[model samples]
Target: MTPTALTPPLMTPAQRKLGMVLCLVTIVLAVLDMNIVSAATVPIVRDLDPVHGVDRLPWLVSAFALAATALLPLYGKLCDLYGAKRVLLGAVGTFLLGSGLCGAAQSMDQLIAFRALQGIGGGGLMSVTMVVVAHLKDPEDRGAGRGGAMGGIVAGLGMAIGPLVGALFTDHLSWRWIFYVNLPLGLLVLVGAALVLKLPATAGRRSLDFLGAALAAAFATTLLLVTEWGGKDYAWTSPEILGLAAVAVVTLVLFLWRQATAAEPVLPLSLFRIRVVRLGFAVQGLVGMGMTGSIMYVMLYLQIARDVAPTTASLYLIPMAAGMTAIGLLVGRLTSRGHSPRTFLVAGAACATLALVLLGLSGPTTGLWAVCAELALLGCGLGQLIGQLITLVQEAAPAHQLGVATTGIRFFQTLGSALGAALFGTLLARVFEAGEPGEPLGAVRSLAGAAREHALGSFTDAVDVVFLSAGGVLGLVLLLAVRLRATEAAAGVGEEDRPVLAA
Candidate 1:
């Protein structure tokens, strides 16, 4: 069936506005939950005091990411099978339930379990929100102008505000308030969605790809475990890491084989045949790795090497956020006016690469203003790249497969984050250990002045290495962006469907 035939009618102005508002709200909450919790970790650890010690603290974050990443593909398929509204509402409700439970948890284990539940809902929120927004716009309105601007603003704002909001909750109220805060906002989103969202009815019953889902989940979980544990909890060459790697390889092969043969594959392999779609995923993955790794390492550099407070270090990111917000909105507007996305994509990649190179060359003697300016450039590149990529994928995908295609881009990005964390962490640890063997920086603070200087220098050197490596990755992204086709399409729904109107 043609995608246009499957699309419901365009939404009325009121319905479209309300629906977009609901999508934005849910996305902000989901993004906030990911970062806000980072600031509250110390308080959480003090209160729960897991018997295994603070070493297991990373699991609090990893558990959520693992569940969210593994379930994203499944959620996309479910949205297509049922309806976007139904699936989205379910996801919101589930996330709210998880948030409440997390706030009330009495043990570290319980908190981790609740986080995994939250991730299940969070995954759907991000994937379905984009699907909802795409459906809201008429094909004629899908150009880079307003559509691009809205998406860019949404992405930039949600990410930029997360850490700041988390810090606010942690400093002014109980750390638990971070989770509890979601309740009121999430309830509002749920009620609003129920009243305003209207999409096409399900076509018919289709068999679930249960086997494919299982294989895919297994593969994702194994890979996440390898990334999270290798070289930290266990040696890279240790039996545990090697065994998990083997399982990941085997499950991936099985998952691909099942997709090719399944009556209803969880992720349709045919989507990869589209040239733009294929390139989009690749560029998205690389950008994800570079962006995530750079953000993390920069924070560490500010806090450890530059002797800045955590809160102060976070404030320094303002310039980057500003650059991202401004450029993202501008590109969206420009693209809507019929400009080629490839232009923004290539330019953005170049900016991102240049920012990383600047950062790598910076030292303790470098001015703070200079660092902030470099970060702003990085933000501009990311803002343009991310916003345009979403538009391109949606434009390229068939309406029937819109949900899956959108979620697929997110899936690759999430995978890239996992890989980036693992890669950067390993590199930093090796460099630090080689320079200051058996002496952690925190432990050496009480030592003589000379020893302290040595520890600080080692950390600075490690940060430089990480930044240089990340810059190289962004350089590759620039090459990929240049190869992208400079085509434009106006995405819209057909007349067979009717727009939902306010009562």
Candidate 2:
């Protein structure tokens, strides 16, 4: 939003606090929906359409991610045109509506469709909440991109706990409650928004690139479909996969062309000119992919490969959160004593990469404590890198373009996670099929003694490849992290506003 757009009223300190709390709640809602479904997938499939749902299960995850990611750039632009307050409330209401529909879905197709609808709302929750946050802060206190460093930590924490929450609901109540529970929480946030939020309104003045938004969403959706279906659902060379790939490439070219020519592009290509912004986008995307690998696949590893129950598997995240908390405290002191944020980034990436390597080296028979240690190390790495990347990007961007720049990095991150889910799914299926020929990963449940053990081993080995691939990607993030240069754009922030990740 334009800084001068209808100068916001002076809100009391209490009101500001309430507003910030509401924003965090929205973050929780978005991040939880992204993750909470994973733990309950088995039950949902069994109840919905067990016959064909097994083959379409990945869609349950991918549909939300794709729909959430597809319109991200446009959401940023919308916040610029309309105020954050209106956009945020609209998103929350839509998400609540979608949640209700998801709870009532009767078939796998219905559930996936509802998830996409929910994602249409979930898309706005994360990005727009940050926009609201920027408006809520005191002008002097306001830093970059809605002061998103802190939100990143909150998001990471939510990602850690979502499965546990999902497991608890699925264990004690039912999987449908996962979506139903959002209703009360979302309604509370809506009330808070209505009561306390004090933000500028800017609807009539800005030029929105409607066509540009359409092309961007089309490109992203097609790309994800190609990734999700290629080599697994269809042969890589088959007409279906080939046609999707062709559509993806053409849509991408058209989107780029439109962005170049549009009056107000959804994502301005000029932001990429800034080195910090460019590298930060790559860092966030790789981090998103790594986080997805760690959080999503770990449950699969524990539940299927090791035969652990879902609730017990979710408890394992406690170690990861503990590690992040410990490292966050240590980094707080080090940065205060005069350390570089870039130093932390490099160190964090190295640690996370090493942790992935350690995880990749493990087998189904590995001890629980040993795997926990690796998760803790991974958490330590992530705690350092996640929040700092966006803070750096927003600081580097020009103030007027803050909304798109902030949302743009998040857009890439969500896109990365979506692609990772699809790509990793394909890899897992192919590797498992190669070793067992005809047996699917799900067949381990029905096999006896030796066959079950062999299937579990093969599945674990396939998961190992996913971790190894993620590790190699993080190794690249480490390289980019090293290339970070200190600049005046970032130097403007006060010590209080700088590198709040550790704080």
Candidate 3:
């Protein structure tokens, strides 16, 4: 606690700004790589299996989702133990290696394996980047630089540009170029990480909990498979559904028991003691469920129901991103001033609910402008919630437990997405089975020149059902948001964590 120890080896303001910019660039690279591969699937499928017999197309996406979500906690724990810089650099290296493998894949199986590898790297990037941000300043100033660099630049730009960038590359160059795009970005991030990111090594006397990790993976895989395949590939009542549900229950219960007794558990059971963390996680889950269900169906409606081309449909997402970016930046400023976060969550969830209802009301008769308006509203609601929630989680928790706390919130978010897809998918299947007054699918089949028209009509009906369901869920989230508390972190906590250079 001496003055010399408290003093940072000084750097100029410009130097610190440069360091922060470089670190954020790493976040953008990781996030861009996360969702870009979706646009390259057509080229990959055509080259690897032109006949289209392989049913693993969805798996290519799902494999990455499962790997990334499941490994979040693992990487977060490693970051806390080994130092964020080392873990982040290692993850970036893995990501670059995976990207190279994906570009060179000769078959669908190879591509999927490579994508899984990419996810392993990506999982670490998201968690550790946030942790680095948390470590940069005491709780007070943590939310300041985050608005531009972390939230708007990294998350907003990455989410918006991913499909657009991927489309451009896949169209003009080659599908492989989408994967190849990561090389320069990843290399640059590696250099920035090596030079600027610094943290004291702090691995405690805990064994790596490999058993807990395997069990957690099993639980997540079973749940995801049940969600993905149930009601779509097989009946919900079938043996496959029942078996997977049983496995999920058993594995999750076993993991929970192991955590309760483990001397140093991977996911510490004690972190949930904070009421704010508990409520924040619950709100995160609900928001995730509503958002994912709504977005997926909207995309489906655009492409299948409206008959918009993939490139055009991707462009339509601009309103959502734009709205989110505007509101997210605004909220970041307000929340940094110690504004009550609960109010923002409630207002945002209400906005989302209203947007979903508007989408439901539109039916097939809605114009493109009307649909875009609805998307914009939903995006605005999301802006107030997403970036703010992560910042709140870090500020509310004890410093050393920051990684696990953030990972827990992320786990719930992933769970919500999986559940939303499964639940909404079931609703769509039921709506199809019940059918409208007329046979919509058959009418589409019977149409000669009107095939696309009737298909669009059926999609309209499905969207009506799905969006209405999402609206109801968001309304519930609004109610839950009322119970969430905005914890006031102590003043001067910021100086304790300030870095020599911006982390």
Candidate 4:
């Protein structure tokens, strides 16, 4: 039973406006959760491990990335098969529940599990928002409504003040407050999306491609597992690493093959055949790897390396946020004039790569202003590309399949983000250990006024090494940018799937 046209329009104007507001709030809550935890890492480790063994610590970040990436496409398909309004409301509910669990966590393992639970919701928050926005308007208006909405979402007041917000939660309130903070906001979004977001009914009996979902999840888990444990939990040459890597390769290949043939496939293979979707996803993957991976490290360097207080460290990040907002608005304006998105993609990737390379070479004594400038450049590059790609992906896709297609773009990028963090974090720890004075952990623990400052000198060098490596990755993203064309983006969806609603 294919869906009938239950509503004259796919969604109401009022619903669209309210949904956008709710979506923006979700992005803020989600992004804040990602960074706020970083500030709590050292303190949580100290409280749990007076002996200072941090073997299980990486799970805090890794779990969230893994769950979010794995669930992204899952939730996206749900939105397409069921309805965005239903899925969005469910996601917010789950996010609230997970947040409560995180606040109550008593052990490291419990916290990791709870965080992963939160990520399941976070995945829906991101993927559904894009689809819902696309459903609100015609393809021509996407840049103004969807792209502008995304820019505003990122440039929103909460994200603009995120570092400061996180610092406040970490400094005065308990670190648990960071997780608890989402409760009120999540509830608000839940209500808004449920009541105001009405979409065309999806009347068909949905058949999820379970085999494809399982294989994709298996592949993602295996890849992340090897990256997470390869250097830390076990030696890279160990059986565990080799076995996991092999399993990941086999499973991913199997997933691809299954997608090729499955009826009602989880990931429509035809999407990759569309030049815009392929190129857009490729650039987004590389950029996401570099940007998200480097986010926490940059903050760590500012607070630990430069010896700034949490408040001051958060304050310094304002410049980057400002740069992103400013550039994002400018690019948003450009999109209205029918400007080619390719130039922006290539230039943004190039600028980001340049900034990463420069920052990677900076030393402990490097001027604060200089570091800030490079960060601003990086932000500028990211702002120019982020909203543009998201909007383009949505535009290229047909209305009925928008959710699944958009989620694919986000999925690849998020997988890259996980790999980046795990790899870079392991490298940072190893380098810091090698360079530390005798009883390095103890020495770091004992330092007083400038204790974090002295410790950061070692961290600065390590971060530089990571940044340089990330720059190389961004080069590939730049190449993909050249392959993007407006015509390709316009043809991202198939002729058959172009309906405004499932009906």
Candidate 5:
């Protein structure tokens, strides 16, 4: 079926506004939870002091990320089977329930399990919100295009504010309040969605591809494990890491085969045949890696090398947040005017690469303002790319495949995040090991003289290497963006028509 036929009718202006608000609020909640815990980690570890050492602390974040990433495709399929509104409401409710449980947890194990539950809900919040926003638009109406950009802004804001919010809660009330804070905001979204969201109900029954879902989940989980553990917990060539890598490869191959053969695939293979859709996912993955990896390491550099407090380190992201928010809004407005998204994509990639290059050249003696300027440039570049890419994919997809197409992009981006963290972390670890020999960086911190200076210098060099590598990846993204047909504008397809791929 064509995309227009599958798209629901547009809502009235008031309803549309309310629906967009709900989508943005829910998305912020989901995105906020991902980063907010960063500042709270110390407090949580202190309070819950489980038997496992501090090494297990990473799981608090990883569990939520893994669950969210693994369940994205399934949530998309559910949105198609049920309605977006139903799936979204259920997701929000589940997230709130998990939040409550997390707030009350007295042990690390319970918190990890509850976070995973929250992540399952969080996954649906992101993918389904996009689906809902896509439906808010009439196929021919460019006016509704702002919804995509708004979503992008909300996501950026959530990421920007998470650490500051976490620090506030941890310092003033308790670490648990960070989770509790979601209750009121989430309830507001739930109420608004219930009152304002009006879409056609699911009229016919369709069989879900359970086997495809299971294989896809297994593949994603194993792949994440390989990335997370390869060089950190085990040697890259060690039996455990190698076995996980092998399993990931096998499961991914099987998942692809199943997609081609399944009656209703979790991720339809045909979607990749569309050039824009294919390239959009690729760009999203690369962007995810570069963007997230840079942000993470930058935070580390501030805290570790510069001795900035966690809350203050988060404040440095203000420039990035501003750049992204401003550029995203502009791109969204331009999209409504039928601009060539490829232009923005190419420009964004170029800017991002330049920003990374600047970051790589920065050092211990570099001025703080200069670094912040580069970060702003990085944010602007990413802001231009992200919202535009979402618009391109949604515009290119066939109506019936909208949810799948949206979720497919997110799935790759999430995978990119995992891969980026692992790859960058491994690179830093190897560099640190080579330079420091027997001493850990933590141990070096306790030294008072030349040992401390040498270790910090080594850490700085390692960070520079990561920045340079990330720059190289962004350079590749630039090439991919340039290859996309610049003539392909963000225009509407007819009810009976499918988007034409450029030759």
Candidate 6:
């Protein structure tokens, strides 16, 4: 059941080398744009509309994140219909266009709109790159799922370094440079892809499921809005959030119905019947959920509690990035020696869980090195899980459904990240409030001496609770990962329970 090692026989060494570089660059452009703005928001607000921009700051992030997440399913279907090369090139062109627009924007409103446009293409960058990888794999590499393995490592590196990269750009040049940088990088890569990358076309022409795409988009949009706006912009029970939630529920039901009945469904419901497919989706979601606490909240802890500057706090992510990069490389080598991906999956969940527990136990007195160590451990777990799960599902997926299966992993993870942000954010606020009654979490910044110390302690405790809760979720992920059978033979032993592999 293990994927055999790949021999680089598909193309000349130079062509493969160039193609790989292009893939990595495209992926960085996509994933980095997701978080890079967080570090430069202050400068952006100051330059655009000092007073009003502060109020609308979150939209800078939400615009990209929401648009990117909502369009993922459609992008996958587009790849299937139009071929990955055509779709990927289009996405790059669109992204570059949006980046240029963003750089030239004179107002915050214009920037936000441009960001949405950027996300339209950014949506396809990460997911579609993997599809391209699948297409680019050698005939001998069939079922290796090694395609996503490198994707995971690069993605982890991108995520860890995003804020730091943003800070460096904003501090050294201009906030707009962050947007401008993508132009040259993307343009060069697009040209290289045109020349060096050779990929397969679609099996045949098929009708585009416009209605299914619309319904699915509606569901994802409303659900993301519910998560983003709830508790912060509006009360959970407020009409706006409630209205969005209702629409999300309604559209979800409709989307499911459409998937079941439509002849050319955008997302085929039958894919869920495959055991690895189902497990992969679920595991990726939980990983996203846990990441809200591990990645985002760690920055909060450093900046608010430890009084580190934002840029400096971002530097702290290096250990985690290093761990992800190191472990990811090691896994590729180990798997090449014919180890099952499940071995790493289970081990990764356990490692991440242990890391979360270590993070949860940290307090104000906890040394900075200790925190870094915990993060490294977490990264080790993530490196093992992120790409390996994709590889597993990819290897197991029926060839005809490759695009859908690939995108589904990312879709669930994005949705889970949204939900996790909402849940952990509320939990942190509530727990901190309980510790320091009638005090806002931000009040710790103003308090001095004893009061400040007390508030910081409370805030620390709240963060700890979040880490522990995330750890608990990873623990659940561990159990689920354990349920994953090592081989189709194991699953096929019971005909009634065996996964339906028919596309």
Q: Give Cα-based local distance difference scores for all models.
A: 0.81, 0.78, 0.73, 0.73, 0.81, 0.83
**Residue-level lDDT tens digits of model 1 in 328-358:** 7788667767787778888888999999999
The TM-scores of all predictions, comma-separated, are 0.91, 0.84, 0.88, 0.83, 0.91, 0.92
> How much lDDT does candidate 1 score?
0.81
Compose the digit string of candidate 3's lDDT tens values, residues 5-61: 111124344544655676677777776876687787778788888776257898788
Total clashes in model 5, counting residue pairs 3 or more apart in sequence or in different chains: 1
Q: 1-503 in candidate 2: lDDT tens per residue? A: 22253225767767887888888788888878877998898899889988888888888878887888897898888877776777788989999999999999998889999999999899998888876776576544433323333554565577678888898999999999999999999999998898788776554757889899999899888888887777677888999988988998998999999999988888888777777778888889988888877777887888998888977887787777667756666665565555656677788899999999999998988998998999889888887876667656755665456568778888888778767777777778888888788896777878999988888889889989988988888898898887664433443434432222210
Model 3 gets an lDDT of 0.73
* lDDT score for residue 281 of model 2: 89
TM-score between model 6 and native: 0.92
Task: Give the candidate order by descending lDDT.
Answer: 6, 5, 1, 2, 3, 4
Q: Which should have the higher TM-score, number 3 or number 4?
A: 3
Candidate 5 residue pairs in backbone clash:
3-399
> What does candidate 4's lDDT look like per residue over 177-234, in tens digits?
8889999999898877777777776657498888888888889888888877877679
Pairs that collide, model 1: 9-497, 139-491, 139-492, 143-336, 144-335, 144-336, 145-335, 145-336, 149-332
Q: Estimate, for each residue in 18-106, the C-alpha lDDT of model 6 and write its tens digit.
A: 78778889988876887688888899999999988899988888888888888888888887777777888988998999999999999
Off by over 4 Å in 6: 1-14, 143-145, 486-489, 492-503
List where candidate 4 sits over 4 angstroms from the true fold. Answer: 1-12, 42-55, 138-140, 148-160, 203-205, 292-315, 336-340, 360-365, 422-465, 486-503
Candidate 1 wrong stretches, greater than 4 Å: 1-7, 50-53, 145-148, 433-448, 486-503
The TM-score, computed over Cα atoms with residue i paired to residue i, of candidate 4 is 0.83
- For model 2, the run of ten residues with the poorest summed lDDT: 494-503
lDDT of 6 at 97: 91
**Which stretch of 10 consecutive residues in model 6 shows the poorest summed lDDT?**
494-503
